[model samples]
Target chain A: MSTAPTTEKGRRTRARIVDAAAELFYERGVSATGLGDVIAASGTGKGQLYHFFTDKGDLVSAVIRHQVEGTLAPQRELGLHRLADLQEWARQAVLQHERSPVMRCPLGSLVVELSNRNADAASALEAGFAQWRELMSGWIAQLQRRGEARTDLPADDLADSILAAYQGGLVLARSRGDLRPLETALAMAIEGIGSRRAPAGRHRAHG
Target chain B: MSTAPTTEKGRRTRARIVDAAAELFYERGVSATGLGDVIAASGTGKGQLYHFFTDKGDLVSAVIRHQVEGTLAPQRELGLHRLADLQEWARQAVLQHERSPVMRCPLGSLVVELSNRNADAASALEAGFAQWRELMSGWIAQLQRRGEARTDLPADDLADSILAAYQGGLVLARSRGDLRPLETALAMAIEGIGSRRAPAGRHRAHG
Candidate 1:
């Protein structure tokens, strides 16, 4: 039970199971989905399922990590070194959502569901988000060093705002199936942080 | 049988059930919270529950509306007329999240869960968001009329971005159990629209 899959075939089977679980859980939600559906979708038998995951709880942990990877895989493909990279990243992100208009942010939608139900799942997601944010902060820090992004606000905070806006925009877009809410927010966000080497006037800080 | 509550007592009972459902769904999630649990929490039997709602689906619709009201109640109490109102409103909004470190936006978290499972619930959530955005846009329009806000951007679009950021900020803050993400996003959002009447140079527009 504690052994790793040594064979490539075994690893493929496990990956397939995780992928199927992610799609099902993402579409039907964690509670509404069953292992049976995952098994059916994965085209794996019960013995194979048990050989990999101990229970639904175990399978869910794998799904959470899988989702984190699914969320970040694209950005990993596209570089994040420049301010323009951030804009391109957000556009690709929103366009990805356009393909599936009803889906929420891949890692974010799961946060709310598991935040209270499963500690392990929530921790896994939080760790994933922290890693993602750290990576994003590093990019923003580079931008600040290059004087392309604002320096007054902490790099981490700027990255957090970008990410927060992305998640919120996804939620709104998903809620209405409109796609405009997301497109508009991200455009404004990219503009908000993408320029202005010097400070501009604003009212009532820390609202 | 589908029926609306006619008597004052009937309405109160229905409201009580919805409130209980909202608390449970908000904490435990809609999929995890059974109607039986809702009945127990609401102190009503199965028959009474059925009288108010045809099934669990019906109850979820009511829960969505209740959550919507829960979100807007405070903001509605205080008008959204001025930029200061938006600031005060955001401060209260972030403070509300401070009370609970692990909960996402009240209506937003629900959006992900129900966006696909139940159409009625999703529709209810969309309507709620639309109404909220409309009210906010009206206030932003008011500010624009007074030359307090940038008039170049459409009032509705700014409202959408603000709502989108709020939802995303809540998701991020909830994931990390820190209020900074939400606070930063809102402060930046408030600042993003509060000024900059002239054009600012920026990178590629709308990646």
Candidate 2:
């Protein structure tokens, strides 16, 4: 709800508030995490928190948007964009899970908690998912155009399937404190892209 | 925590507390809901509540089990079993989404909130997912043996994929308040079962 800060100090303060809010929301859930807690954690006064956010609803939307970017930044740079094999993405997902075995998909966890609870927050969550799914679907489309993926379904459908599997896998993974479900689901999803039929003779053994 | 109810009246009181707690948990969230609210909503005293549940943690596991059965009962009876076409299941799922457009998956919503917060509750959620997956996998295995489904991938993989897609679809669907994501994801999943080869002439000619 607040306008972008013109000063560097103001921007830093705003970012600090969002980060504190996100952590509290993730750890204790939205309704239980109050502005007082956020103020305390961020070490910002009520005047500054209010200057940045119109209210709790406004802050929750900002938090959801913040979490979506945090969750996707690495995948865009480190995992998906430069990888030659989609399976590499799956492998990295497992490794990340091994590193942090208990956190739910940040955006996804927000969706379940806020989807039906707040209208403004729900729309923000929807926008976050759409942005992430668009990035994933763009990759699926590129693979399809190159004939490395299934043609029987629309690229959007294929992309949606993979995203769904991933989100669901995270739910099970976090619930079980195990990464196998995420690993298996992602592996099967990549297989669904038809990577196995990549003109078998074209890429000969290097050795 | 508390001992199992030994009398019919005690069992009913315990069930009432669980049902009321589940409603509050689903409406708000586990952390946001209080035992006092549950006791008030269920018309039970604090002593009665404690007679059945030792604490919030114990009640949460009960709530998850309760939610799981609630989600599966209709599917087990009117959906998924003895269906000549897997598409039927997808269609019904879409219809159910239409009927209940605003609510999150009961078990799944609990998962995003409690998975990492409590180990005992997380195990209960995991057991719930496994029970649902097991039922679906049993059906998939039977279909494979009858030559009505894909034989290339293991039935457990197929089942897990379907479950993951379904869970993910619910997340997306709830986030957007649109049924298309769920519909598309499920349609693609049923197709993954490789159902096109169901006896060329036996079930054909009707079209």
Which DockQ values do the candidates obtain, in the order shown?
0.49, 0.34
- Highest-scoring model, TM-score: 1
In model 2 chain A, the worst 10-residue window by lDDT is A198-207
| Candidate 2 residue runs with Cα over 4 Å from true position | A75-84, A115-117, A195-207, B76-85, B195-207
**Cα lDDT of all candidates, in order?**
0.80, 0.77
lDDT of 2 at A96: 69
Candidate 1: lDDT over CA atoms? 0.80
**Docking outcome class, model 2:** acceptable
TM-scores of all predicted structures: 0.92, 0.85
What value does the lDDT take at residue A15 in candidate 2?
Answer: 98
Return the clash pairs for model 1, or none: A168-B168
Evaluated with DockQ, which candidate comes out highest? 1
Q: For residues B44-85, could you state the per-residue lDDT of candidate 1 as single tens digits?
A: 888888998898888888777777887777777887778988
Per model, kept true contacts as a fraction are 0.67, 0.49
Here the TM-score of candidate 2's chain B is 0.86
TM-score of the A chain in candidate 2? 0.86
Q: Compared with the true structure, what per-residue lDDT tens digits does model 2 show for residues B1-207?
A: 666999999999999999999988887788778899999999999999988888889999888888989987877775444435556776876786687655467887887887465887877888888888777888888887776677777777788777777778888887777877787777767666754322232444111
